[model samples]
Target: MLEISPAIKNLEKEDIADNLLHYVYNTKHLLSLIKKGIDLDDPSYLSSYRSFEGEVYENFIYEKLLRYAEENDYITKFVLKGFHQGKCKAYANTLSISEKEQIVYRTKSREISEFDAMFLTKNNELYFVEMTLVKSVLKLRRRLRKKKALLEIIFPNYTIKSLIILNEGATGAKQFPSYCKVWFTKEFSAAEVLEYITKLDKQKLLPKDKINSKKMIEAHMLKLHPFRYYNTMSWITKTIRANKKYVIDMNFLMTEKVQRYHDLYNKFYVGFLTVKEMKNILHLKEGEYSEEQRVVVALEKKHSDEIVVTYYIQTTRKNLYLYSFNDAKVVKEKKDPYGITVTEVFHINKLMNESYLLSISQVNTIKKLLKERFKRESQKPNEK
Candidate 1:
C-alpha cells in the first residue's frame, strides 16, 4: 500500500466543525465533484469514498499533465468523456473501461478500473501512467511492474510506454530499478511530465513484449485494483477549489494586475495588460478599479458582451495561466513559484482580448461565493 506524509494525511481529516473535510484539497477531485454534483457541506456525502492521501497526489499530477498537454498540443486533442478528435484524445482522472479500451476479467468477475492518467498521441501511441506517493522503494518498484504488465495486456496493438511518477522530497539520490524514469516532485513541476512524454513519443519507445491472455490480464487488474479515478475526483475538487491557493502549490500559477481579465478572456496562451489599456475594452474611466473587489469588462463573443468581476480566495492556487498560441509552435512565459515576483512574459498579443489588471478588493466575497456555489451545485443533479 502507498503511504502519505502526515501533512498530507491531515488534509483528509475532520475540520474545526468536525465535518468530514476531504477531497477539498485535491484538484482532480474538485473538477470531478463539480461535474458530478457531490456535495461537500454534508458529512454523509463524505462516507461514500475512501480518504487516501496518495489519491490527492495522483489527482494533482493527473490534471497538470492534461493541462500541459493541451497548452502544448502534445496529444492534439482531449476529452473528459469519450474520444472526440480522432486518435489523439487524453483523459484525465478517468477510467479505461470505456468501449475504446477496456478489459473484462472473467476469473475475477470484473473490469479494469481507470488509470491515474492515460494519453494517446496523434501517432496512436500510448502513455499509460500510474502515480505513487510513498516512502517504500520495494513497494513502489513492485507496483510499477504490475501496472506495466496490465497496460500492455490491454493495449496489445499499440506501442506502450508505462511510466511511474514517484513524488519524493528528500535532497538525496532517488533510484529507480531501470523500469522507468523516476521524477522528484520536489525538484520538478508536475507539468514537466508532458515534456517527457513528448520526448518518448518522438522516439517511439515500445513496451516489453507481452503475451498475457485477455482473461488473465483482466483478472490481475480487477484483483489488484491497479488504478482509480472517480470518488477521489469528487472529494479532491472540493478541497482544491475550496481553498485553491492553499491546496495548490505556487509552481503552476502566477498572479498579476490583470489575472481576472486574463482568466475571463483567455484567448491566447499568454498576454499582457495594464489598467489603462483595458479602459478601451471595458469602457470604464480611470480609477474605476480603485475599490479593488469588483470590476467589469466587455467580451468579443461569449456569454455576454460585458462581464462582472467577482473576488475570491484560493489556497490551492491564485494565479492565471496566460499563454500566446502560435498555432502548433507555441511559446509560454513561466516563473519559478518560490518568489514574490511574477514571471516574465516571452510572448503576448495585445489585440486579442487585451487584458487589464483590476484593483484588488479588500474583501472575501469572492471566496464565499465560491464555497456556496460548489456546495449548491454538488447538491444538484447533473441534468440538461
Candidate 2:
C-alpha cells in the first residue's frame, strides 16, 4: 500500500506529483546512473530497474519532505555544508523557536552521524531529530536518543524531546518507548507535525527566569567578542591598552596614524612605505591591527587620488572638519581651503600626522605667501 499524506491529495489535484515524479526520474535518475556507469541509452536497462534508483530516489524523497513541511506551515531552513562534519549534505529541516542563539546543534567529530535536525518551540522547549530512510524502528529510536544526548550538551538550558521518522512497515510505532514519540506513515501526517509545532504556546515553554539568565550570558559574551565598531577599532583598543601607562591623546594618535598611513598608501609619493612598516609606524601592538583594513585603504588609493590628498577629516552631526597647517598664522586650524567639500569622501585613516606635509600645490601656496610677506616687509621700510 502506498502511504501518502492527505495533503498529497491536494498536491495530486494540481498534477504536482506527476511533475515532481518527472523531475525525479529524469534529472535525478540520469545523474545517479552516470555515477554508477550504467548504460542509460538502453531501454531494457531502464525497464529492468523500474523502482528505486539509489541516492537519486533519496534526494527526491528529501525534496518531497521539504515541500510537505512548507505547505503545512513549518518555517524551514537548510544548511548544506560547514554546519556538519563528513561529506557535505542537505537537510530539509525546520526550526520553531525565536531565540537569538542557535538552537540546532551538530559536531564535526562524530564520524558515523551525518547531520542532526532540531525544532525549538518559542517556550524554550526543543525536539532533537535524527532521520534515517531505514525502516527499522529499533535503529531509529537508538539514533534519535543519541542525537538528543548530543543536543543536550550543545543546548544545556533547553528541555529536549526526541522523534524518529522511518519508512512504513519498518517497525510498529508501538515499539518506541513511552518517553519518545515515533511517527509512522499512518499515525503522523505532515499537517499534524506542523500543527503540533505551530500551536505550541511559547509563553508557557519559556520561563521568564531562564530567558533573563540567557540574555545576561549573551550580553557578557557580546562584550568579550565586542562588535567591530570601526575596522580598526580592535587595533585601537589593543594599541591603547599596550601603551596605557603613557598619557596618550586619542585624537592626536589617530591624526598621526592616519597621516602616516596616507603617505605609505600613496604609491606615487616619495616616502612609499610597506604595510609592515606602516603597522610598526602606527605603534600597533602585535596583531592588534588587521591587514584587511590596510589593504582596503590601499585599494581605495589605487582607484582614486582624493583619499591620499585629504587630512585630519572629522565629522559631526551637522558638518565635517578638515585640519591642516596654516603657515600664515603658523598654527593648525579646523578649516582649510584645500579640505574636501563633499561629505561622501569621509574615511578614517590611522596615519594622519602633524609632520605630514601637503602636496606640491599646497607647498607652492605657502611659498607664495612667504614671498608676499617679505615684499610687504620691504615696502614698509621704504615707506618709512
Candidate 3:
C-alpha cells in the first residue's frame, strides 16, 4: 500500500495542461505547435507528458517523506557525507537523504560501487534507502545485497540498516533479509517509520571480524557477478560521458591506486596547452592544423610525427568528445540519442592504434580491455 500526497493526487487536467504549455513555450516549441495547429497529440505534448509521467512516482515518495518528516519531527537535516569527503549540508525539506554516493575500489581495475539514497541519523546510524516500483523481489534482493556489501567496505563502523520501499501490492516482502525493513507503499504509517529508526539505534553493528578486506570483497563481488571488469568500465564510461563536465570530483578518491586516474583527468582539464603554444610545438599555422569544435591541437607525440590530444567541447545541446591524431578525421554517421558516434579516424600506427597516444597507464587499460573483450568472445561459442 503506497500513499501519494493529497496535493499530488488532486492535480487537475487544466493544471497539467498549463505546465505542458509552459514547457513548450520555454523550449521554443510553442510557436511551432501554434503554426502546426493546437494538436494535443503532438510529440512536444507527448514529450512533456512522458517526462511528467516519470516524475509522478518520484514526487509522490518525496512528498510523502517530507510530510511524514515534518509531521513526526524524525530528522534534524538532510546531509551528504562521503567516506573521505566532508559533510555537505542542505536545509531539511525531505528525509535525511543523501543520493547517488559512490565507492571507489583500490584494485588494478579501479571498479566503483554507487548506492542510491542514504538516510543518516544524528546518532550516526544509517539507512540505505531504496525506493522502487520494481515488482520482482529476486531482483530487489540481489541489488540490495551487493549494495550492502559495498557499504560495509566503506562504512564498517556505522550501524548500516536497509529500508526498501516498494510499490503497493508488490509481493515477496517476507523473502528479504530479517534485518531489512520492507515497506510497501500505502501500507506503512509514519509511526512505523519512526519506530524503524528507533530500533536501529539498539541493533548491534556488523561484526568487524565478519567483514572482508578490500581485496577479499572485490574477489567476492566478482565471483557473485562475473564480467565485472566490463560492467565496471561501462558504468564509468557512461557516467563520465553523461556528466560531460570532464572534471573528475576530487572527493571520489578512497585509495592511492586511483590517484593516477585523477592525474590523467587533470592532464586534460588543467594541463591543456594553448592553441598558440600548440602551433609552436607542431610548427603548424591556422590553416595547417585541423580544427573541429575547437582548434584541435597536438598535446603529445605518439609516433615520429603523429600527435594526439584529448579534449571536450561544449556544444549548444551538450558537450562532445573530440580527439586529435596526426591523420585523424571526423566521420559522421547515424547519431545516437546523444548525437555522438564512433567517428574518429586515425592512422593505424601500432602505438596510436593500440593506445590512442595515451600514457603507459592508459595503454595498460587497453590491455585489460583486450583481455576482457576476447574472453567474452571466446565464451560466446560455448553458450551455443
Candidate 4:
C-alpha cells in the first residue's frame, strides 16, 4: 500500500510540479492547481482552461513530462503516447469449475485504464510511473498494480518498473507491487526530482545510448549530400560579397598544383591571380627619354598628367635629384642626383577594375611604379 500523510500530500504535488515546470511551464501551473486542491478530474474545472485548447490537458502533461526528463538528464528521445483514464486495460483471469462431471472452464478479462507517465531508458527498459498527492494509500496501491500489469503486457522486452512519487509520509512496512518503487518527498522542488532522474539515468535505465547513436549517424549521412556543398558555397559567396572592406587574395594560384592545372587548361584557367598580380598586369610606365642627352627624366604624374612631379632627375653634372610628392620645386633641385631614392606612391589602376594600391612589397615595386604612372591619367578626385 502507498499512502501519504495529509500534510505532505500537497508538498509532493508541488515538488513534482516545480521540477516539471522547470521544463514545462503550463503543466507546472496545472500541477499547481492540483496542489491547490483544484480537481483536475472534474469536467467543469477543465472546461474553463485556456492556453492550448483542443487536448490541452493531455498536451500539457505530455510536453511537461518530456521536458522534465530532458532537463533532468533523462532520456527523452523515446516515443510518447497519452492514455486516457478508461482507455487502457489491466489483465486478469477467472476460472469456473463444473460440480458434477469434472468439467472446468476459465476466462481471461481486461479493464481499460491510464497511467501518468512512461519512460524508456537507454537500456530499453520501460518504467511505468504514477504520481498522486492523493491521501488514499489503498487507492494508490491499486493504481500502481493496475499500471504495472498493463506495462508488463505492452513492454514485455523491457524490464517494467514503477515509480510512485508521493507526498504522504511512509505507508508503514507493507509489500508494494512486484515491479514498483515509491519516492516520498516533503516539498516541491525541481532539484529533487532532477536528482532522482539523474540517478535513474546513471543506472542505464533509459534508451539514450542507442537513440543518440542512430541520430548521429543519420545526421552525418545528411551532410554528404551535394545540396550541402552547394549551400556551403553559396553561403561563402554571400559572406565575401557582404564584406566590402576586405579584398579576396587567391595567391594559391602561385602554387605548383594550381600552375600545373592552369598549364593543362592552356590559358582557359587564369589560375586565380592575386590583387598584387592584377595590379602589375595593368601597370603602365611613364618617363621622358632624352635621345640627344642620353638621359631619362622619370617622375610619377598625378591626375592624368595634370600634375607633373619629378621623383628622379639626371643632370649634366652627373647628379641625380630625388623629389617626394609633397616636396617643393626648390627641395627637388637640392637633393643629390644618383642615389636610388625611394618614395611611397598611391595610385588606382583600371587594369584590375580600378582597384587602389596602398603599399607595394619589394617584389611588386615595378608594378607600383607602373600604377603610379597610370594614376596620373585617370586619378579620381577622392585619390588625394
Candidate 5:
C-alpha cells in the first residue's frame, strides 16, 4: 500500500500508520500553491513542509529539474543523432509502484532500483537523481552511493552524474564526492539554473577528467566507498544546535501548522450548519461505523479545545448553527483557518442560507448519536 504517513522510508515501514490519513490531504494544498506559481518560500509553505516524506521535496525539485531540462539541451527529441545534438534526455521516473520495474547489473546481478528522477545527455551520459527531505544525511549518503553504483552499471554506455538534492542543512561536509554531488536547495535556484542551462548550451563544456584533477577525484573515490565517511550530517546538526535559527523556527512551524489544520477543519465547518450536515462532518466515507468514527473525532477535537465548535439554533436562518469560534485564534479575525475571510459579508449571506433542514427530533437524534460516537471513540463500553 502507498505510505500515508510521512515518517516511513519509501513506504516500507508502517511504524507511523496511526498518523496516516492527513498526508494525502496536505499534499493537495501544496500542489494547489505550486500550480499558481506561488514562490515556495513563505512560512506557510516552509513550516508545513517537514511533515511530509521526500515526495514533497521530490515534486518541488521536479519542477526545477523539469524547467532546467527543457530550457537546456536535455529534452531534445530523438533525432537521427538522438536529438539536442545527442546531448541529453532527462525526465521523471514514470513507473508503477506495485511492480518490480528496474534495470539489473549483469556483473553484480544487483538491481538499479526505482529512481526519483532521471537525466540522459546525448554524450550518452546519464544523470540519476535522488531527492530527499530526510534529516539523516548519513542514511541518505548510504542509500545514494548504492544507487550510484547500480545506476552506473545499468547505463554502462553513459557517464553518470550521481546527484542527490538535499534540503538545506542536510549535509555538513565542505568536501564531498566529485562524482556523487549533493546540492543543497537553498544554495541553488531553479530559475537561475533554467536561465543558465539555456546559455550553457552555447558555452563550450570541459570533459569530466578536468573536473576531477585534484581532491575531486578523491571525493569521487569516497562516494564509491561511502562507508569510509564518518564526518556527515552529525557535524552540521551540532552546529545547528548552537545557532537555533539554523533549524526551522518552532514558532512559525507550530502557528502555521495548526492554522493549516484549522483551515481543513473549517472547510467543512463554515459552509454547512445543521444537525445533518454537522453530524456527518467527520464522515470521510459512507457507512454508519465511519459516520460514528467521524463523530468521535469531531467531539475529540472539541473536547480537547483544539477547536471551539458548538451548535446553536439560528432563528432567522431557520436551522442549527454548527459554529466554530475560529476567528478568535487568528490575528484581526482575518481568516478562519480556512483562508476564508472571517467577516466577509458576501459569503455571510450564502453561508447563512445554506443550512441544514432539520426537525427538532432529528436534531436530538444526531446529538445523541454524537454522545454515542464519543463513547465509542473512547473505546469504553455503554457509557454514552
Candidate 6:
C-alpha cells in the first residue's frame, strides 16, 4: 500500500506527482546524458525537459507554502485549501470553515484552469499562487488573466489575490496584472515569501499627534542587521571625539558616517521616515509637491501613519537608488515598558519607488547624490 500525506492527498491526482516522477527520471541520467552529447545547459534543451523542471519547481514552492501554513504563526491565519497543477473539477465538498469550492470550472468557455496553489482565510479572502521558471512573463499573462476571470466568477464575494512566484528574476514583471504580486525566488527566501503573503495591512498606526518621540525613534531605529541608528551614531561620535580637528554639522556627519559605514561594510542603513519629513526632503511648494504628496499621502493613509514608511540607503556601486517602501504591514502592535505603542516588525509589501515617486530627481536630492555617490564609490578599491 502506498501512503500519501493527508494534506497533499487531494493533490495526488494533480501533475505534481507526475512532475516529480519526471524530475527523478530526468535527473537520474542527467550527468551521463550531459557527458554523452546532450547538453542540458543549452537553451535548446529547455523545450524538452523544462516542463519537468517547471513542475518540480512548482512542487517545491507548494511544499514551502505548505510548510509555512503549518509552522509559521503569520501563515497560520491562512489554510491551504488545495493544490491543482492544471485542471480540476469543482467539488461540492467544502472545508469545515468555508463552503467555497477550491477549484472552479466554467461550462460556457469549456476551460478548466487552476492555479498551482490556493489558500483561504476565515475572512473570505482567497489567495491564488502560480510558480514559473521562465524568464519572461509574456506567455503567462494571458493565462493569469483567464484564471483571474474564472476565480472572480466563482467567488464573487471573496477578495481574490494573485501571487506569481518565479524561479528567478524575470523581465516584463510590470506586464502582470496590477493586482498581482510577483516574487523572484532568487531574490527572496521561502520565509520572506511567507512573511509577505501573510503580512498585516489592516492594522492602522497611531495618529501622528498621538505618536510619541519614543515610538517615532523606534520606527526610525528599525534594524537591518549589523547597522542601526544608535550603532552608527556611536561610531560617528567616538570618531569625532577622537579627532577634534575634523569639524562637521551633526546632521551632515551622520549622513557621511552612515555612507562611510555602508561603503566599508557593504551594509545598508535601513530607517523609517514620516510623511512630513518625506515632503520636507522634496522641499516643494504646495502645487509643486502635489504629485509626490499624492503618492506619500496615499501610502500614509493605507498604513494610517508615516511610521510604516521605510527606506534603505545603499552606497554600493551596483545599488544606485535610495530604495524605500511603504505599506509595511506590522506583525503585532503592542505597548512597550514606556507605555508607547510599537510594532514588532514591519514586513514591507511593495517597493514604492518601483511603482511610485521616490525615483524623482528632486526628492531627497537623488540626482545630485546619485552622481556624487557613484563617483565616490567608483574611486574606492574593490571590497575585500
Candidate 4 has a TM-score of 0.27
List runs of model 1 lying over 4 Å from the truth: 1-51, 76-108, 111-114, 122-124, 170-179, 187-384
Positional deviation of residue 19's Cα in model 4 after best superposition, in angstroms: 13
lDDT tens per residue, model 6, 137-171: 77687566556644554455766678777754578
lDDT (0-100) at residue 213 of candidate 6? 19
Model 6 pairs whose backbones collide: none
How far off is residue 95 in model 6, in Å? 12
Sorted by lDDT, highest first, which candidate order results?
6, 3, 5, 4, 1, 2
lDDT of each residue in 132-233, candidate 1, tens digit only: 655455645444443454455445565555456665653222454343544545422333222333243544333322222211122122222333222222
Q: Model 2, residue 13: what's the lDDT?
A: 25
TM-score for candidate 1: 0.29
**Weakest 10 consecutive residues of candidate 2 by summed lDDT:** 207-216
Q: What value does the lDDT take at residue 338 in candidate 1?
A: 33
TM-scores of the candidates are: 0.29, 0.30, 0.32, 0.27, 0.30, 0.34
Give the Cα lDDT of each candidate: 0.34, 0.34, 0.37, 0.35, 0.36, 0.39
Among all candidates shown, the one with the greatest lDDT:
6
Worst lDDT 10-window in candidate 1: 339-348
Tens-digit per-residue lDDT, 1-384, candidate 4:
223344333332432333222332234444455457877567644643333231233333344444445444344233333221112222222111112111111113211234455555666566655655444567566445434543443344677677666544546315565566676655333434334433535432322211112211110111111212122222332332233453322233234443332222111110112333322222312323232211111223232222232333333343544433343323334343321121111000111121222222422443354455456536656543
Q: Taking the tens digit of each residue's C-alpha lDDT, what string does model 2 give over 195-273?
A: 3333546223221111111111111111111112222332443343234333222233335443333232221111112
Give candidate 6's error at residue 104 in angstroms: 6.3
Residue 300 in model 1: shift from native, Å? 64
Top-scoring candidate (TM-score): 6
Q: Each prediction's Cα RMSD?
A: 22.9, 25.6, 17.6, 32.6, 22.3, 22.7
On the 0 to 100 scale, the lDDT of residue 90 in model 4 is 22
TM-score of 2: 0.30
